[model samples]
Target: MTNPFTRRPGGTPGAHLPLALCAAAMAVLALAAATGLAVDGRTVLGEPVWLKPFKFALSFALYAGTLSWMIGQARRWRRTLWWLGTVAAAGFVLPEISAITFQAGRGVRSHFNFETGLDSTVFAVMGGAAYLGWLMTFAMGVFLLSQKRTLERPMAWAVPLGIAVSLAGMSVGYLMTAPTPEQAQALDAGLKLATIGAHSVGAPDAGAGMPLTGWKTGAGDLRVGHFVGLHALQALPLVAVGLRLLARRVTVLRDLTVRTALVVVVAIGYGGLTWLLVWQAQRSQPLTSPDATTLTAAATLLGAVALAAAGVLLAASRRVPARTPVAATR
Candidate 1:
């Protein structure tokens, strides 16, 4: 299908250039990162230097694309709204990716790096950009909430709720900025500190981590939660879209309220899972090896979702009437 977001004001392709351009730029960065990884054997924090850039570029590409498509669906003040969003992407968002890529080229950690003046400056820029970008996204979410929508029940909730969830996910990064025990001890001693914070909590930053992603193998890695939370931007809305597609084959999905209920259940479950990941990370537990407690929590969460889904389906079967025509749901 022709994506509406890729088009300009009158159904041509252009106007959302800031977001589209960011997506394109990220793709280029991904290519460059791939090349760098292949040619340069240098590793930072025990991982390939360009690896961070490669992961970040691909993620941002999807992030930007999703936001672009979402804002493109606006009916009221579309041009102005998208223009404002585009500007936000250009001004605040672009700097973030740029800083990461720049630090990658320098062969140093981009995050929590305050060792030197230049690294501190770059990290400061990234922090500032994060704040501004989040503020802009919140503003966009509010504006989206105010506008009337033509989407189905699931999608209608998905777009704005996805933004809300993404905001929470973005906020999760702040936890990584806090001082660890060692850093706190150094600060208490009034000694100069090179790095104030880190991604790994119980373990050191450059310790043994999972392949490719570099998530800490058996320690509290904040990145896991941050990654999971941030991607909900794509996950939640895409769930709604996937359900809509499934409706063609399953008659139970034809009821508007049923679909809405399912969306709510999934959203709640997704949010729960995000929190679970953060909780697990904070406890210094490796994601690959969740213990009994973590396993129980996860099982409980899954059970709740199943119960809720069964309730929705059962209620729909009794209340919505069997084989309700698809048109009636709308």
Candidate 2:
């Protein structure tokens, strides 16, 4: 029996090395954060400029590490997948992180900055890299789905679900890039400014936030959904693993039907939450400030999810075989 985490002999090195290197970079950034290195400007959240690099470094580490683990499980197209994943990291992730870090070091905004030729170029490059990364993720999801039988049942389902949800979540950022009415008016008023691409809605990016996350407390922030959706890759698979362990302990619930139903339920719930966050952000409502509309929408989502879960469980129960009761020895 082989441990999934350990690299097999003669296996092609995938994103593991790049992920490790990124981890090292994250360590350096963490040190910088701790040392309070001289960062020229604060983020829109008024946090130390080092915070951006520190956060991105951690995110990249998780992204690379999770993908590397999944790629290692690939029984077919191992080398090709490795190459593709590496290209994604090198061509997309690395460039984006580097550009952000570079801008942070210079005490300037990396995103939505069309003020100068250089800033516009960097922003364009980052945007291109982001699109490429999303495409690569889509490809990875397709490959995982094609090889579903080779993976653990929970993981097999999780891979595609996670990627799909993450992409959906990421799409919300596009709305933020559109020029607000005020921004358009400003542009028409002889201002050289092109558009504001920041994440906050109905308010400026600079404001009171929730500690390190920097999510706006006063207004809607699309990054909440974006962050939650991106992490589904990790969160879903982890929940699947836990469910598998629980199934082992509970004999009556050991059927694959039950386990699969649980996974489906969790995925649906997770997706609903992602949508709720995005919807809330669009309405310019803070996470903490839920009004009547929010409550009604939330209730509807929960009711729908509950109905779906019941249907799945009932359908599964009918298909699954009844367990034989064992007679106790006298």
Candidate 3:
């Protein structure tokens, strides 16, 4: 079967440019990874530079790939693709643009000690990156829902509405805490210690002990947000499939009931997984602990169960009752 996203109109693919850019960006990322690994020592490489930029580049490439594939489908899909492209650009630009403000104060200072000012420039850049990331999800949700073949109005709104609520809640919390200089310093110390213990915080190390660097230094609740946020990729898509199944039977009470139950099960499973992540972060235990190990195993099991149940429900919904052929009245 033809890939739904990649179908295009005439000769010479419309996405050629974007696809080429994606390939180039991926190549750059590969080079950066090799270079990062090949260098012997920290100082010998001068500054560990290419990796961060490469991440941004790869993000663009992924977005571009999505756009290239989607834009050629139909007018509606094309519109959706345009929005997605805008979203992708914003995701890449926001952090870089925000970094300018951050860099102005520190002038390329990437180190963090307790003495480092509370307004660490990288925070601004990262915050921008994160906010943009969420917005990208919102746009994606809209596009997914806009699928004329299978889109329920309520489900379509969920992505944007959920994001708005999450961001609002987070913003309210930020406003509530106007940390003192001393408090900020303490927070910095805690973060630094966690980073030191973890050895590597970010910039994907396949061998790195910690799978999640986002929760390394954060409190439980904060860590939960980051962890769940990370898994949105899986949770959202599963939920979407479930919703599509659920919406089909909305008019029929019996089938609707099954769908509703399926949706609830899916939501609860995803929510539980999210909560566990937060709890783990709050606990701040190393990944090697028996308890942590058990919890991870349990979470994986739950995810598998949820996915399996969803698939079963979707299949069952598609099965219509056998129809007898009508007698020839003529």
Candidate 4:
């Protein structure tokens, strides 16, 4: 009997196992949150302790599901790639979730905490696992790019573009780990800060936040870009599929050229938005606070997208053959 998850052409059932496990983990976290079973500690933002686990669980579910589906779509090395990818993902993700959940249960901080030797070791291990996971993800991206012939035109473009954008977003996390100017000044004053990493700029992490997202409402929060950037892996493919479906309905846009061009436009727009978010965070401005520069940038981005889309449409129209007149068909 063949493995259900190893279906040669489009085997995605195997990926579903991990995704379901992640979903179940999230459900447990949610139940813990609702029942107030574990409310001993709070995050830097003063949210419930279980919030971090819940967030990670949800993110892992999406990540696993997306990559598994992509790998399933491939015709080569289906089983080998699936197992390798799953291992890499599990290696990093499990350690992270475990560390966070364990620390939360102990009512202690998990990140940027080096008070105890054990805590330091855990943090170091998690960091190492994270780097390994990134390397594996990069390898997977390269593999997908090389398998262009086996993928749909839209997916062929989406996979690489999505990975690139997501990596850019992940890089923003480094900024949090680095010492901010304020922190450096404090260090100069002989003050010792608890943790070197922080998510907010120009304001304390304890500042006001949105209801569910916990994004800083009073200052720049780098996590916004980080969140949007990583989700592009899912967003771009969904956009590509939507475009393909639309092309089927519109005869004039049925060509692969038109579909690819539209997908490119969407990718560019998505990347631009991700950059805009990073820029906004760097400026220490709240997402809701748009100055003149922000307005100008937004307008410029919109204009560029419109022009690109129009150009693609015009080029596609030129390529379409003119209908020959039928001679007097009574």
For candidate 2, the per-residue lDDT at 172 reads 77
Which stretches in model 4 have alpha-carbon errors above 4 Å? 1-5, 8-44, 186-192, 321-330
Candidate 1 lDDT, tens digit per residue, 231-298? Answer: 88899889888887888888888877788889889888888888999899899898887989999999
Selected candidate, larger lDDT, 1 vs 3: 1
Best by lDDT: 1
Which residue pairs does candidate 2 place in steric collision?
Answer: none
Q: After superposition on all CA atoms, what RMSD does each candidate show versus the true structure?
A: 3.2, 5.1, 9.8, 5.2
lDDT of 4 by residue, 1-330 (tens): 465363434443335355446546655665665444354455544777666666766776677667767776666665556665766667866777788778777666777666678877777776777677677677777777776776677678888788778777767766777777887898789986666667888887878888767788899989889889888888888887887677655654666667677888988898899889888988888888877898899899999999999899888778765542211211
TM-score, cand. 3 vs. native: 0.49
Question: Residue 321 of model 4: what lDDT?
Answer: 55
Per-prediction count of colliding residue pairs?
1, 0, 1, 1
Q: What does the lDDT read for residue 61 in candidate 3?
A: 48
Q: How would you order the candidates by lDDT, starting with the best?
A: 1, 2, 4, 3
Off by over 4 Å in 1: 1-15, 328-330
Predicted candidate 2 versus true structure: per-residue lDDT over 1-330, tens digit per residue: 432233557653334456556556666766675454454445534766777777777777777778877776777666556666777788877899889888877777777888788889888888889888888888887776776777667667877788788778767767777777788888779788834677788888876788777788888988889888888888888877887677555543456556666777788888989999989988888887888999998999899878887786677557655662221211
Instruction: Give TM per candidate.
Output: 0.93, 0.86, 0.49, 0.86
lDDT, each prediction:
0.82, 0.74, 0.42, 0.73
Clashes of 4: 1
